[model samples]
Target: MDRQEDRHRLDLRLALADLVADTAACVRFFSRLPVPKLCSADDPARLPDFSQISRAIPLAGIVVAMPAGLLVLLLGLSQLPTLASGFLVVGMLAMVTGALHEDGLADVADGFFGGHTPERRLEIMKDSRIGAFGSIALIVSLGLKAVLIAALLDRYTPLEAMVILLGAESLGRTLIVWQWSTLPAARPDGLAHRFGVPISKTFKQACIFGAACLLPTLPVLPLPSLALGLILAPLAAHGVGMLAKARIGGFSGDVLGAVQQVGTLVFLAGCLAVA
Candidate 1:
């Protein structure tokens, strides 16, 4: 019995260590945050293994958005104009993630609309320059998100607003993982392809973890709003997936980014509509 107890404790410790390491890997991958290496075995130069680390992506999303959420809470307490506070929080989020998803939205817009051929579209997406379609896409998405967030702030208390923000961030990332798991990489050589599609078990675990992350908001948000947000967010992601399939045959990194942006917006919208 003594030996069995010792082995069980060892197993629990190892699992805890792995959980910390995976969360750290996801934070490093998704944001520009300066997270120190949590595990001795982690290589600083190596990319995270998404197949494993993807399970922690939703948790990482909360960590990534925590600063912005705090900022919104402060602004709310200060009685700042709702619209202005919304824009500020959105801007802070962009800075936090280095506008990573926004850039992808722009790239997808440019590629999908500007180029007639798949080869040309892929080329356009790879281009560093932003075209007219890309510019317009960025403007519309950013403006819409700001408006929706402002509406939420105007309707709810600061604490509730913070929960909503965290929920949106995590749900958006869950959608990203969903797409990464379900769709094949559009290009043979790109970051998405290199990360590789997660196995079925990893995807299921990620969904479970992602759902767990949203539980905190249940007490703060209405049941109908939360349910609507959950439903609509995944539907929006599905629409994006269908569009990507029709245009490029599969998803690229940019497509995944687009999915996140769209998913986040739809989730917020659904929540606000019934809140």
Candidate 2:
């Protein structure tokens, strides 16, 4: 019995360590944060194994957004104007993430609309220059997010608004994982293809973890609004998936980013509607 108990304890310790490592990997991948390498065997320069780290993506999302959320709380307590605070928090988030999703959204907009064929679209996406479509897309998405965040702040308390921001961020990253898992890579040599599609088990684990991350908002948000947001967010992501399927034949890294942006917007909008 003593030996069995010791082995069980060892197992639990190893599992906890692995979970921490995975979450760190995800944080490193998703944000520009200089998180230390937790697992020595894993290469620091290479892309994280999304298949394994995906289970912690939701938690990583919360971790990534924590700084911006804290900023919101601070600004709210300072009695800053809601609109200005909203823009500042949004800017902070963009800085934290190195504007990764925003860049992807811009690329997707430019590529999907600028070219007549998939080949040309892919070429356009690979180009570093931002065009008219990309510029317009960045303005609209960022503007909408700031406005919606301001609206939420105007209605809810600082703490509640912070929770809502965290929930939105978590849900957005969860949708990215979902789209990455469900859709095939659109290009053979693209980042999405190289990263590899996550298996069903990984996706299911992500959903479970993502749901757990959202639980904090239960007390802050109205139940009906929460449910509406939950239902609409995934649908918005699915619409992005469908558009990707039709436009480029499958998903790419840009598509995943687009998924995150659109899903987040829908979730926040739904919540704000009834708040």
Candidate 3:
């Protein structure tokens, strides 16, 4: 019994260490933040819970996926010398997020537009199958993104293009944190609970996570942009919150994702318009 107790205590310590390391890894990935190696795929022993990493998921997403947008802009720059890369960068970045929120947009559209009642809407949203309204929503959203991005790339240089990609992604992820903190879970025991931390932790993460977004904007836009972004984030979140209330009756994981993606686009659009 004594030996077994010792082994259990040792296992618990190791598990805690692993969770800390994974969270660090996620943050490092998001901010282009660096860290020493911690875990490997070949390890035979099971590590810790993946829940801690959820806090940094958005950050990690931006780090891993933003480059795709850059690549698309580069391709456009090479092919069309007259146009700048900014638009392409934005468009590509949207794609890089893999139309993640766009999927939410589609789901919401189908649910709200087609279903007669709130319960019916929720039912439609839960269905994995896509509907006509959803399909149309996806097409239109993607088309808008493609056109806007192409326009930006046409106007801006490669460096500006890069900043836009990074900024938009970081901003988007930061926006996602707000939803996580503020919105009530739409479905009981759904995906939100798995990823949801306490509001206090969520706020701390938002502040730290926000730096990735705000730092880049300092050079690109003026104080107005900064002020606007700060103000707009919550307003945009509130708007989505209302939409969530009306449609799904609350925020689901899909709605949360939609908010992030939509919020990013809205922020970028507002910034550029000010510029």
- How many clashes (backbone N, Cα, C below 3 Å) per candidate? 0, 0, 9
TM-score of 1: 0.96
lDDT of each: 0.88, 0.89, 0.62
Q: Estimate the lDDT of model 1.
A: 0.88
Scored by lDDT, model 2 comes in at: 0.89
Tens-digit lDDT track of model 3 for 1-275: 99999999989888666545555565453333344555542122333222344455545555644575557546655866423343454445445445556667778878878899888988898788899998987776556555555545655665565566566666766666666666677777766555444365645665575675557657765677556756776578678878888776778767766776677666666665664
lDDT ranking, high to low: 2, 1, 3
CA error at residue 67 for candidate 3, angstroms: 2.1
Query: What lDDT tens digits, residue by residue, belong to model 1 across residues 1-275?
Result: 99999999989888877877888888888889998877764555677888777888888899999999998889889868899998999999999999999999999999999999888899999999999999999999999888987887888888888888998999999898898888877888876657767777877877888888898889888999889999999999999998888888789989989999999999999987874
Give the 10-residue window scoring lowest on summed lDDT in candidate 3.
Answer: 41-50
Candidate 3 — what's its lDDT?
A: 0.62
Q: Among these predicted structures, which one has the highest lDDT?
A: 2
lDDT of 3 at 178: 65
